[model samples]
Target: MFKAKNVIRIGKGANAVLARPLSGIPLAIWAFSLTFALALGSTAAQQTPPPNPHSPPPTSVTHQMYLDMKLGTLNIHGDNAVVEALVLQRDIPITYDYVATLMRTPNAFGEGPACIVCHSSNDQLKSYRGLNLSSCEGILLGATEAPANPIVIKGEPFQSHLIQRIRNNRMPLGTPFFAPVDTDSILAVKDWINAGALNDENFTTKVLPLFVDPVAFGSETACTECHKSFRDPPSFNEVNLTSYDAIMTGAFSKTRKKQNLPGLPIVVPSNAEASPLYQRLTTSRMPPGTDPGSPADHPNTLLLMRWIEQGASCD
Candidate 1:
């Protein structure tokens, strides 16, 4: 009736005893006992239950998962130390859905909704400020026509512009609206920055254009035709295309009224195949006044496809 622990201890002791030979009779008896004990110990250990190696360690609990809703892929990873803190301190799984919820209803400082919600040139929050959180390339790589500089995301908080603003408390100011941000949100951002602001397990564009050059697409004009006058408010389609902010927010026709299709938005960047704008340009369905042209005959169609393939980012 030996318990699991006792069985193991007895097995070890039998081995030690059997290592040295005593009187013939004692040694023979000891050998038999040792064999039986070893077998029992092994059986008990096997039935005791195997450790869950895949389970994150108790102290480590930084969990992250990326969902490219359009791509239909789920990328997941975890750091037990960080995950534990996220669970115990933040009480949330670091998943795309979770992050999206945070972004939609961000804290005072506007931290959440993932990077695309803020860095994108077509973000809904463009009207509030000229900030685009869709892609880091335009803002961080200076790929946009405006020529923004690279945004470093490493080292001390002072080194990074994003961190500096957060640390200096210059962000989440109450000019247009005022709301308090949570300490945990700020810490999470700091932790992300400290970790080199990695895009691993996150949806990212494979290639980013140097600039949103309409000329490259054989268009002599910018997106001013239908997007101008956004600098003021209530721009065409309730969108502003004057700056990165406006463009991101205005690019897509959210309401069904403005949408080309009966029940679909004009632009669904995530689903290029389903977007009416892309279908119109890439296919033979030109607008009312434009000359009827085939999708293959239109160079702009290729450009639009390339843009969509590049995540349709305004950055």
Candidate 2:
């Protein structure tokens, strides 16, 4: 602090200053100095650069405003004026169901994309990271590893881990680098988060799939015998293959010890090798002690394989 004549010059770092005085200083001089300092500060603040509204104010969250110009209904001078004058284009609000669509659909973001291929309720990878990106609720609930932070922050898009992971290509592991989630999809996630991630009021919730429908699966291999009951060494108790919808839902493997491959799908459409349902039926792996068995040549097994290869339409 430096005192000169009647005004005390208070140093406010390199770019600003505070002007005050003691009782001994002349009140008139002090007042004049204070006015001049305020004027100087106003000019300096204006010339500083574009104001970041998000930044906290020096004294409090409240900010000082002084507008000198106006045109029509718009302010043409001052920080708020500048911001109000410029047209800020906003995107349409995104819904919770929309995010789920991105997760379930293949190549929805673009080339060679598949999120549900690995992050479903039954997917082995879901347990590893504890994130089931299969549904909106799952995203909001977050993963076991990040229990403290929700995957999607309601109004802060960038703050959401879900968006950050997609933006940084940390999701859909094993996907080709050239065909990561597209920009539009990434932006959609951000927009959805910013829009409050509302769910569809009319959303008809269905049980997540465990396997392709055995009835619709075009198979007659008596799947319910082993799947419905644990009479054999391996029991498919996690899922019921008897019902059409139940079959389409997930069936986590009891034998797969790896927790890292969470939400692994059993009936990924259009890809035979990707679908465990198609694999188990086609091979002698199930109905134990049937290596090169009679079931391998069974027409029902062939029908099931064809159904999966044809994109396993649950409809």
Candidate 3:
């Protein structure tokens, strides 16, 4: 440790300041150095971090904030301030507190008990299908150890058995905790799982805006330019790329209907290769002519594909 006194040569007058020495150093010099050191320490301790506009507010609720930032009320998912608050942070956080809340909150409309009540496991009680919603680990580990049909498919929410049950009106046992498990709630879970079923709330805050933000996107063609609604009439295929919710909520495909199958989701959370949006950029190039546009590994197409791999957060 470099002490100020060691580096500082006392002036010739030092002997006059305090003739008596404490240990070896003069008492007056020691006192002055101690005072200065305390002052510096105090200043450093009191220093506030440079304002981080992207950090979540102390009073903000993660679940509510997630919903608020992605309500789909406007074409832009959230205000710039709110979006920045969720992004631009040192390290994106991971938490499933909101999902836990979803499982525990009593159903206002349904006569049945909360999801947790029936899905939890304990010495005295065990839910059917061995599903346990009481903890994050249990949910991710899923119902059966290795069922023929898996419960949660990590990056594929639609394929997850849990979502399938809710969508099919088979969950919560009785009247159902959320009537039909409100679209918003189901979407929340979908976002949760589609994000590789992790707790990173940044999964929604940091990614997905690339679709509309051409500057950040680093390309002449913005995906939202053609995909987002608000055109003269409306976007082709009714696929609104305006926000996270819109992109995740894909448009119907006649091809799938012809085969009596469901259409593939445009952006499948953490799976870009499986996403049709990426597929178009690679095969059957999207922007039509231009001698067939950018290649599959083109920077622009790779950008979109990469976004999905990062959980495709909308705001």
The full ranking of all candidates by TM-score, starting with the best, is: 3, 2, 1
What are the clash counts of all predictions, listed in order? 22, 19, 3
For model 3 the local lDDT of residue 42 reads 33
Q: Number of the top candidate by TM-score?
A: 3
Looking at model 3, the pairs that clash are: 54-85, 95-199, 207-313
Query: How accurate locally is residue 171 in candidate 1, as Cα lDDT from 0 to 100?
Result: 21
lDDT digits (tens) for residues 1-315 of candidate 1? 122321212234423221322111133443454444344333332223344579554452212211121122221122122122223233332232322232233221222233344345633345213444433343444223232433333222223333222222212111111222223333333343344433433212210120122331223433344345433234344433344333334333345335563422433544443333223222221121222221222222222223333333333
In Å, residue 61's CA in model 1 sits off its true spot by 6.0
Report residue 120 deviation for candidate 3 (angstroms). 0.6
lDDT values, one for every candidate: 0.31, 0.38, 0.42
Task: Determine which window of 10 residues in candidate 1 has minimal summed lDDT.
Answer: 202-211
Superposition TM-score, candidate 1 onto the true structure: 0.21
Write model 3 residue lDDT over 1-315, tens digit each, in one string: 123443332222322122121222244655454333333333332334454568665464444333332332111111122122332221233235434544564531122346776678632236655767687667766765333234566555555545433333221112222233234433444444456534355445544554555533323555666667623234655566666556655765444556886544766666654455543332321121212222223222222233333343332
Off by over 4 Å in 1: 1-101, 108-130, 135-147, 152-158, 170-315
CA-only RMSD, every prediction: 26.2, 26.3, 23.9
**lDDT for model 1:** 0.31
- Predicted structure 2, TM vs. truth: 0.25
Candidate 3 displacement at residue 166 in angstroms: 1.6
List ranges where model 3 is wrong by over 4 Å.
Answer: 1-94, 108-111, 122-125, 145-149, 170-252, 255-315
